[model samples]
Target chain A: MSQTVELKVDLGERSYPIYIGENLIGDTGAYLNKHGFKTGSPILIVTDETIAPYYLDTVVNSLRSAGYTVVTHIVPAGEQTKSLSMLEAIVTTALTGNLDRNSAVIALGGGVIGDLAGFVAATYMRGIRFIQIPTTILAHDSSVGGKVAVNHKLAKNIIGAFHQPDYVLYDVTTLRTLSPREVRSGLAEMVKHGLIWDEAFVDWLEESASKLLNLDLDALKYGIHQGCRIKSVVVAEDERENDLRAILNLGHTIGHALEAVAGYGELLHGEAIAIGMVGASLLAQKLGYSSDIYTRTKALLQKFELPVSLPKHYDVDAIMEAMSHDKKFKEGKMVFVIPTAIGKVEINRNVPAEWVRETVEQLKGEA
Target chain B: MSQTVELKVDLGERSYPIYIGENLIGDTGAYLNKHGFKTGSPILIVTDETIAPYYLDTVVNSLRSAGYTVVTHIVPAGEQTKSLSMLEAIVTTALTGNLDRNSAVIALGGGVIGDLAGFVAATYMRGIRFIQIPTTILAHDSSVGGKVAVNHKLAKNIIGAFHQPDYVLYDVTTLRTLSPREVRSGLAEMVKHGLIWDEAFVDWLEESASKLLNLDLDALKYGIHQGCRIKSVVVAEDERENDLRAILNLGHTIGHALEAVAGYGELLHGEAIAIGMVGASLLAQKLGYSSDIYTRTKALLQKFELPVSLPKHYDVDAIMEAMSHDKKFKEGKMVFVIPTAIGKVEINRNVPAEWVRETVEQLKGEA
Candidate 1:
């Protein structure tokens, strides 16, 4: 028997159901049919060069067996590949392929392909339904969240729209191919869900970190399902991150800065987030929130073999400046997510900026 | 005393309040204060070479006296200025200007500046709050709508986000300097609002077309207020345009095609939309909606001196291809906004592609 995860993204009727399971890839045909996904339509599959040969054939074969006309667009792999040049190249091919509004794009690969293809779906004749078949572990968080965007050289996820996929097929099988680092990066989010919203989930991570590290299938399924659930509910409540959804940034504030300061792809997102979660925890403890929760969060992160501190040589001022540019800061104060309790997170902006500076200095001394 | 027209966009908490009055420009400071727009924060004013030279200092003076720190960025002006290169340049400046996430951008110009600056605010630090202080008739519609995006050569508004302004100040006095052509483009949206969801507003446009053309402040305010109301209602319901908001594309389907096919900036947006609206109305009539509605909509458009048909020289295939690439067509078939009834709309993908071809042929014949 398969289990269904309910994501309550709060876009009213725009809300959708996300089904996670082992053989979702083989069964997507029915989900497609059930959701009014046009049958026998010419479908353009936008994927990365790295992910296509491995998975495109499966999706294409499934789509073909289901009686659909499939046209595949294979883009070069890498985050750098998500550019105007790439978008135009695919759009030109899509245009040449007689692709129109009725044609759907299956974004194969991780976040980049999802965003690039989703943008293509969004602006191509206004919008189209695209299904996300995320292949990377890092995508476990990004793929389901309705925040589809591509990066500019100056910023990440800079140009995008709030485009929800018609459906998301987690296909835990895809994670089997992820590198060890990818698995670790994705684990940060599972831990993030625990620290920010779910206590039991946190304890679950603390116990199952070994199973996840070993790529245990059931553990992977539980982690992904629960992480998606946390995000889905927040998204269901605040699809645009205007309110409670912003809490999902439990570790993303400093996590993104670490990635940016370290130069993107330098620090694994999950690794940075693991460190960020510690920083947020320490900040929470600094502001006198919960010392026990902070210590436990760090201990759990350590158990996963994730780094909970920055490299010794990284510039503190640059990190601080990068954080100042973080999207969470509002009204001239840097907003930090601090745990009020294990299951409760509060968006804290009133905490003195000097304390953040002090933490940076303290961390520098410890380094 | 001046009357204020309110645009109640239903984006839950992220929704902003729009104030349309005779002197919204002067009231910018007071309104921002009243609406919880943080005081003593860094403000970046985005303007263009054209409008900035005229009123930038005045806006700056107002903010400075209100005890706010204001920084100004001036771009060359016009639709051509709304590009990726320009966005990069401004971001560099914003970063150098030491813009933190707490800072706000005040977009102080027409649609181009509003879209460009709004996108900057949307992208900067993953997103930031920016206020809209529009200086053109066209901006009355755009400034009120939360559809902030930038143009890529592949698609107009291809890259963007649905980030609303903290507040919108639509100063009617600013419209006096706009070219007759600019004012005409602004009316396309007012016309779209009536065609999509506002039957009484359609009657109002019919009754007050001359007043709009004559630059009657009362009629213009009425038009903007009603347009904002319709847009706000749709946006509030579907901020990301997953459903009800798609109705806003009544004429834009063909209008965007006309703009792209004719070459952007060749035909003003409103002019293309006017022609597109004519084509859409004609298509709607042919699809068995109502010939009476078509005549009435066309006559009302004609009264505004909006272009009623496309030029004979434009190839139908070119426009069709442009529409194919329209950010509206979802999968493969072109979706049309056929009148379920005047002021009521149902997105009709059931309309054949043949109807689009036939309509274009008829339009060419009329030309």
Candidate 2:
């Protein structure tokens, strides 16, 4: 039996736990039962085509062995799958499968599957219980926050709700099969977790960058655990980004803009955020925060092979227009999560457009 | 100023108030501001084309005069608009208009607009604030409960969530413009509220049936006020329809099936529910609850000119098939809100399919 690290997210009645371990998907029945998922109730496992063949059977068989009826919905892989058309299809599938309020939806892949399935659960039959079985490292950040949505043509995640899952089953074993780019994409958010909230976590992540990249079991477990822990605390305090929770958007403002301008799926979410974080840091420095902190952050990102500058030939105007479409924009003003120092950030809603343009131009030159 | 009756639906953090009156739409600035809506925040007013021509400007101007920036999204009139495609369009419009987390969505039409717009608010940016400005009498029932949804091809309102509004602004003045069939349709739910909760209210409604149909201001105000008050109490006790709230579905089990079988819009929601309520009473009597209750309930429905029997040409098998798609079906068992007596009902999860079939056959003869 592999060692499992369990942590609880305190969200009053909506609270659930996160279990991080190797090969946990093979025996998820115990965790399912502990979370009040009763035997005989139908469970719909929502996974992508890419992930379905890998671990879907293990989860289905485990639940079936426990006397629960399980159904599977295989969505196409990629960001395009997170659209209203896909949402309608998933809802139709759930309804056709006869899932009721007692029935549960299991999101069994990475952030895209978790988000698409989670939104289905949030609105199907006006809400039902759902569990998250995240397969990628980036999901460690997304699965915990309970912010599930489908993307719109105008903006990404523009249509969604805050529906917390019953529990998150994180099997670190799945990370071993990821491509290097996928691993790097996931590491950007893990790096972000340390950059925004904990100085010690940042120092530890920097020290273990090599081992972490190599998929060291201990390093993998600690990275996901710490990322989820920070997210859980922030979500607990501010379930709906009313105040402090916006800190979690440390790099997402410009990150989402980059994804939109470059066309979604052209850049993996974390890759875009990796560049956005560097832009934000530079913006912070330009705003008279700290140049020293920006240099340190840039160095760490480089060590992990994450992008720290905008892509060459990308239009700054298009990115700025995309940022204006972000939900964070209030009454025509752009809001950015700027770091003043390592392990600390501020939501600067009054950042001028000229400063963003300058940073994008400078970052383009650097790239 | 016309008299206004204010009632609160208590669900702790999700609690909101319902204001019933005439001409409230003309001066909604005070209500919007009172409900925590700040000046200068963008507001999306979602209304159907039918209602938009009548009441959209009143609302848009009212909010604008109060220092708020308002945008409008007009959906086509009818039940078909309660769909995922329409939800996507409205969300795209909100995004295009740059509505944010702090911005609010105001549903300014009847039940369809309220449900569609409410679901949009429920999921937009993971839940933003929305106000309900119900323009139809049918909305008196749909608005008070936090049940918002879009219809699935498999079933009506199968895709939705329990997203409460900041406040429900019910202007009875809008009801005066409704057609005779629309007035009758709205009255059915009001009558159901009485039948399920208060015997005295039922008697009062029976006495005021003529005035209600004629659109008397006093009767309209009282009917909506009492109906909302009952719904508010039930929702407060069971926000998610776990146990107690299921009782509010009095006639909906078979009612929804009747609508689905007949094809949506071929039968108005209240018309279908009115027939379902009578059928439910008959089922209760057949199960040895009380035959006298069925007779008395039939008299009240007939007095309001509401349908009390299934259509002559409807198929029993098709109705049963539709019932199977209902959300109340639990683990292969169909659940019905059976009336034991006036002002009393029970959520009977064990009702046999044979009883439903037999009642449908019998009701067809009566029709």
Candidate 3:
């Protein structure tokens, strides 16, 4: 708490701050009060089963001590929890809890919980305030953008809204409990922030990869702070993802397809995006869009120990079909955020389908 | 089309027009294209079985003729149609039909259809464009306000969003197909538009009640246009119901409770609202907030042949319990939109529970 790093996502009245700190969750009540969460208003804390055993009691006690009525809805942990059925179940819990318009919902987990709870806040009573407590590094990307959603069976994040949070409270101490795979998974998105926007940050992440992996609090804090800052800048400018924000989906094109093709269970989201980023770099190089983009992007992702190739078991045609179903897919064109440099990308709207198909094959390490 | 009357809901960039006329559904394609719905974009038409048999083909043919791809999802016609299950099912259709971010959804029915489809559009891809092809007279009120939602089992419209439509196409010809009860149910809202904001409109409605009941096209169009114009003005002033727009809920607090108590089958929305309005006026008189509000309101509702009294079978405690679950309920306070005059209301944040209970009993015509 003594060395908190804060960034603001400015969207006029909907603007909010993101606090990256240590042990902030213990002071959740104070933060909620300082951020204008109405006194005595009810709150719903939505977390995953995995996180509940660790932090739910602390959050509930903090909120209760603040004289606010608190309710908890714990969901099963995983990507599958981000579904319409879960949304309905949580909404029912909200109703039974008597959450009113003045009430707030706190998302107390990773990307999946943040998105699900944010959407509940977004649609409950036509919109209520919500706060994000991102426990995973991957949420450093999802939490800042206000892009809350659930995945349909056919597509990932196909049903969602751009409902900004009141603010985001990131307590890095929660990261200590994550499995090695989860830590690597979150690092992929942290790396993505640099890949899409800041060359120097990407260079720093590469240098500090081992320190971050070993959970050096200082390095982890600095890395998460930098990642969040980049994401907030992009979100503040393009909250709705109209034009400029599309750049944030740099690797999502093939990344989402890979996830869908693998049934969303084989790879974590950040891992999928890491592969997608590698694939995009390959395509960029093939099209002469950049110099050494494939080698450089792959190297950074590899440093983070993230996957850089699609599993050989994935079918190319299935991946293509999945890409076609993506929310970003428009008018029968393969829309890719192609990197022109280490930290610069261009929206390529008409990438040849065959090029993408070949890139899929290449990603299988066959080429 | 020549007699079409147009008015705009001034919401800046989200602003849209309301067209009141005859046979607008047959020209929905032209309207969609004219309103910037892309020429080649796919569209999903969401309507109930009742309206589907009547005008779905016309909408489908109209869009197809204009070189726009079209898909349709039809649900059973009733208040029950607005639910999370149905929302998910329609989202599935949108996905399977390949409706993209560029595509649009057309809601072709009454308030139920408008709200359901608008929510689908609002959430599909975080929101795509949608048009309101309102086929029932009751929609004159619901279609104008950007309040789109589905009901949870415990409350009416508890889960929803304020996603405005691209435009609303109100074709009076469709009103001819409505049964007598349905016509009266719609007129209840039309009369309410007057009760909440315009004294002269109330007077005019009183004089033209017979014509509106007969489905006289000219009277219907004029009534709808005025109703929409008044609603649009309120919505523009308070798009999110934070302040002035709350006046629009004059009877909805009690009305929504009735709908929930009655299982959404015993009363059409407008009918429930009509009884609720009478009760509101009665409470206002008792509170000394207004003069002659009760008699005049009951007279106007009776002129439209809408129910002014709650049925005798309803449990008072049950209705009271249901009201507590309303999105509008707060801090154990009974929030009611109380009439101050024949054409104006104010948000009453704290009405006595005992008085509300008495008023509910009085509304049963037992006093």
Candidate that scores best on TM-score: 3
Q: What tens digits encode model 2's per-residue C-alpha lDDT throughout A83-188? A: 9888888877877777877899999999999889999988888889889999999999998878999988877787888899988889999888799989989999
Instruction: Count clashing residue pairs per candidate.
Output: 24, 2, 0
Docking class of 1: incorrect
DockQ of each: 0.19, 0.78, 0.76
In the range B274-315, model 2's lDDT, one tens digit per residue, is: 988888988998889878888889899999999887777899
Chain B, candidate 3: TM? 0.94
Model 3 per-residue lDDT tens digits across residues A219-318: 9889988988888888788888789998888888898778777863688888899998998898898789765888888888888888887767889998
Which candidate number would show the highest lDDT if scored against the true structure? 3
Q: In model 3, which regions exceed 4 Å deviation?
A: A263-265, A289-291, A309-333, A357-367, B260-266, B289-291, B310-333, B364-367
Give the per-residue lDDT of model 1 (tens digit) for A314-340.
898888888877654565567888888
TM-score of chain A of 3: 0.94
Q: Candidate 3 — what's its lDDT?
A: 0.87
| Residue-level error in angstroms, candidate 1, position A108 | 2.7
State TM-scores per candidate: 0.76, 0.93, 0.94
Listed for each candidate, the true contacts retained, as a fraction, are 0.13, 0.91, 0.80
